[model samples]
Target: MYGTAAHNTYAQNNVGIESPTRLIEMLYEGVLRFNAQAKKSIKDGDIEKKVYWINRSIAIITELLITLDKTQGDISLYLEGLYNYEITLLTNASVDGDVAKIDEVSNVFKGLLEAWRESTNVA
Candidate 1:
């Protein structure tokens, strides 16, 4: 409980202090980190941890999907499809214990993270 509270506080602080672009980059980084954990959990035969991490990744993706500005036109539409595909891959990986599926999602996010950093000049 203390750990979670501390982590939440840290995240809240970041939200308050960080630029919006940096926050999005952090979210992408988070998904990749969670995907790595989920993949490791599958390899270790730890079903509970696998599901937990995969669910975390899915939640982040869902948040990103929902927060997208559809008013941006084609980019938002493209991202909606891409994020949905990532969520589907994460869900399937959770059920099938397929590390490759996790890898697929990770690959996408890594590219997105780099692109985000470059485009946003975040860092």
Candidate 2:
């Protein structure tokens, strides 16, 4: 546990060591978090905040795709393909107002993150 924490701390300190897979996983998690916040904001009657999270979620997916392409030529390409599918799902979820899709994406990303952490020895 300490080792994992230490590795996470190390990764936080050194962004250079972050892989595309890690970035995509982080973005996936962020989408869930931000969307939840957006939902709350909507419930609280704040249209702006709702839009904020929606836009943020979209931005994260967009950036993930671009970053994946830029980070190409390693294990990144495979990861990119996986995320591309996730991104498509996310896009559909956004359009269809399907909260369940987010959960599905979250599950898929959790698996991806686990594999990435094991292979890279990252936390």
Give the winner by lDDT.
Answer: 1
TM-score against truth, every candidate: 0.95, 0.56
Give candidate 1 regions above 4 Å deviation. none
Please write out the lDDT profile of model 1 over residues 7-119, one tens digit for every residue: 99997987999877888998999999999999899999999999999999999999999999999999999999999999998898999999999999999999999999889
**Candidate 2 structure quality by residue, lDDT tens digits, 1-123:** 999999988878765676666665676677768767756765677766656776787677667667665455766777677667777766675555566765677677667667767777776
Clashing pairs in 2: none
Which run of 10 residues does model 2 get worst, by summed lDDT? 93-102
lDDT of 2 at 41: 66
Question: Scored by Cα lDDT, where does model 2 land?
Answer: 0.69
Lowest summed lDDT window (length 10), candidate 1:
114-123
